[model samples]
Target chain A: MKNTFNILATIILVLSLSATVCAEGWDVPASVKKKQNPYELTKRNISSGKKIFQTTCKSCHGDPGKGNMLPLQPPPTDLGSQNFLVQTDGEIFHKIRTGKGAMPTFEKTLSDESKWMVIAYLRSLDKMKREAVVTKAVVNPEVTDVKIDIDVDSEHKKLIAELTGLKKDGKRVGLEGIELSFLVKRAFGQLDISGEEAYTNEKGQLIVQFPTDLPGDREGQANLLVKITDEDNYGPIEEKRVVSIAVPTNPKNILSERAMWGTRANAPIWIIATYVLGVIGIWGVIFLILFQLFQLSKMRVKSK
Target chain B: MTQKTSDKSRRNFLKSFGVTVGAAGVVSSFSLLGAAKAAAKEPEEMVNLLTADGQLVQVDKNQLRPTVTEPLNELQKRGREGIAGKSFVMVIDLSKCRNARKCMDACQNHHQLRADQHHINVLQMQDSEHTAPYFMPKPCQHCDNPPCTKVCPVDATFKRQDGIVLIDNERCIGCRFCIAACPYSARIFQWTEPKDSEKYKDLTYNIEANVPQKKGTVSKCLFSADRLREDKLPSCVSSCPNGVYYFGDRNEDAVTNGTTGVTVRFSKLIEENAGYTLMKELGTKPRVYYLPPKDRAFKFNGDLLNEENLH
Candidate 1:
């Protein structure tokens, strides 16, 4: 009986442990877990991975792989957590390729290289202390003289930001291969331009065309902010510029206001007058006939 | 004695004729006075009148005329004159919709609509078998030249200057003329008394809000005219998880997506997206425009195919 009791206790313990593992943990094969990631964590790969994550994963996994828990039944795993970070790249790759439960299979959607790049991007997030990366440049303090000039072309609806790198001698030179981000400040928050990150051209300028009808304030004024985000060479520099767009005017359709076909407000004066006159004229004639009939009845009584 | 009796009868007849003529003249003169009063400009003084129930009521001298109330009151008037200097417009991007019925739910809650009554409906549309299915949310087109308003004998349904079409439930006679005339089939008639709480039931009806909805009246989307007056986005626009609907003043040429808070050029969005109004051939000149379902975010899952399951 003592041996049986020990056996039963062990069996129950094993069952509960397995159930817990099945519920939360993935069942990755041994061979798949041992497989290695073939891609390197290069700057280009990390950026590409960021783009993919934003477009594909941000909706469910959130901005920094924190996992949006509201919509999912069994919430998505937090990719930034240590429990997730401890997993090998092969396990993650296999789980992504062959999805389980609520997670979708991304094998057909992402190429192997893209998958590896995304894994690298996820790995990089483990080092981030906060949700957003705020890089303060301590490298070259002399690059503080960079000036950003913004011009708006109303006809084409384009906003051009020109970045001029100024030397200590006060000479203007164009900076190349620097990433610039342009955003429009709105009432609620900032609206970033689609394809917001742009590298400076040969002229050291980044031009972005806005939608023609992008609304500004009540006065038709839009505020644009341009930032230079090159942490390695220069500190973060931001410039703000204001531009005015055409304000929409009221529609000029007078026919809508008229009361021709039973519009109550602006009914024609003549129609109301005619209707009233006709009612009075018809009623007067009927009253006159009724009086004549009464007069005739009196005359007949007199004759009798 | 016979001559005396005949004389008395003649006197009675004369008196009766005089009374009849006097009454007729008084009635006609009152009508004439009403017409004259309508033609005259506003008077500074107020007027007192006796109603049919023997109650004396004091009213504005201008309202003494039989013409429709010059300045519409809260209950008796149609809200045909929209908020001035505004022309509202909406744009729906079909590519972003994933049959999330949050817009409908929001509208129903805000409007206090019945289960069968939907001011905005999401329809499963497939142009052809080769094309992928997509969800199309249909609200009242709020046409500039609304056919529904034209057929309304009572002028209950009318277009406002701000590009909203509203129904005056107090004025609607339940003729269903507007319903028949509407090509979009946007209007819904309340067949039975609406199940409303006592609070809404006791409240006076406002056309802009269409709240405390009455039975045997036609109701459709008013584009949240009351909310517009408050300078807020419509319930559906703000409630959408996906940025499907955009609302703005066409006069402003800018439409903001309530979900993303991204304001875009209304004309440019329509032009670039090859946006088309529903049944453009009808020439309804709808205020609503739809962007095509190109490059959709998700595959058209057949979840909404059986709409009964959605309820």
Candidate 2:
């Protein structure tokens, strides 16, 4: 019985050791766990945190904190899970600041305030998840009323889009912290404004400098589109506005246009004149030689 | 008395001329006998010939001669003209390059060039010892005001409207004047016969493709003009894994990265990246622009030192 007990104990010890070895167990220090997050959970902090997450951590953590399943040796932790949420804010902050195994340490990269902001953002994600659940239970979620105002300043060469909306609570509010993608509807497809996703300001407005070279219709009219993409709280909303862009009267640059290296039609007058003269001179010489040869042949025949 | 002497001298010259004529007849008769003997063993086979003006004629096999002159075909004539309504441009982001040498390999393979001859070169550049090192790939600039085209006496090298500088090997006299004139050192001379297959030798010469490269002719990058005609990316641009090169029509104001398939506005990308052309002071007006090596993805490791050691 003692021998069997010894074998059983050995197997248990080996299994536990192998498990620890398989995944390098994260050891969060007691002191680190006690550390408190300093940043307040505000909308601005959450937005900046979201931006950082999208740029840096989203590649592995995915959009909603669901792990991307990238076949890592020890897979990434799902940040949105109940187990992850149960961890103290300090524990999450320590994990991000002092990375373990596959995760890289962002201590040198991110500041202390930024780390706290990320933690606040993580907490807000839990609220978003709860809100999403409550939203699904509602029979008919009222679509947010969205309005877009387009102004074309031809003198300054700027196209500005002013957006305002009414929340479901019957309150007129500026759609702050929402992404507004501005695009010019082209013949083939929509051309993105500056290839950048524009975000609305606190006043619910996004302004983009009109591209001076953007071609328009026959009447110099451009179809501009502003869209607020679908998210957890709001349904998708879009607005299209037609704006008259200034007709570009500037002439083409001389260097880019009819230069010497350009097409034959654009060849310089001097080159054409020289070419014509050279051709005529060579042909004239040839004709003159033939005429002289004919005269010499006649003269020789008379002498014979 | 002098007239009498002159008359005598003239009579003497005539007497000598008669003797020489008599000797020439004897020699001619002997040659005719030799010709008769040669004709006895001559082959009777005769070949038919078609004259250029559509006249059919027959000639002895010995009388048949090879034509020494041939005219340029349709493709060669059309090659001088550029594609209509297109102005090509290339932008290279220096921050993205890591001396992969894939562009050089692709260019060499497509051009059928030897190991020493490269149409694209990845050069290691460092402004100073204090500054960081970067890899700069140098290809033919295909300048809008190309110095190489100007010095070409035979018009062998010419620029097209679509922003490509091409070399017509048939017209190149191996003078190397364009090579001397080019500031970028982009041109290369084929000092020896190209080591190509017999099939390539039998294939018709293409001015755009520049395949079966001839000996003693100057050659440079054509921006893969033949490939451009097919609406395909240049070999170097498509082969690069780093998306260092962006090529597109300047008139359309768009440039696309061949590797990443990321299209950006030509003017905006240049403006945002602070793109600058090489040797702008020279006024060559190169179509290729370079984005400064800022915000590099990877550290400038000592790999360039290792590459230098290999060299």
lDDT by residue (tens digit), candidate 2, A1-304: 9999999999999999999875666688899898876766655566667767766677877756555646676677676666677777888988887797789987645656767877777777674344422112222223367766767787777767666767678876666646666676542235577334366666777778778777554466777787764345355667788877734333234334555654344557788789999999999999999999999999999999
Candidate 1 Cα outliers beyond 4 Å, as residue runs: A1-98, A101-242, A245-262, A265-304, B1-80, B126-134, B294-296, B299-311
Worst lDDT 10-window in candidate 2 chain A: A132-141
Clashing pairs in 1: A213-B265, A214-B265, A248-B251
Query: Which tens-of-lDDT digit does each residue in B232-286 have in candidate 2?
Result: 8889999987778998877656677877666677889999989999999999999
In candidate 2, how many Å is residue B245 off? Answer: 2.0
Docking class of 1: incorrect
TM-score of each: 0.58, 0.57
For every prediction, compared with the true complex, DockQ reads: 0.09, 0.03
The per-prediction tally of clashing pairs is: 3, 0
Q: Can you write out model 1's per-residue Cα lDDT over B223-250, one digit (the tens) per residue?
A: 8887887788888999987788998887
- The Cα RMSD in angstroms, rounded to one decimal, for candidate 2 relative to the true structure is 17.9
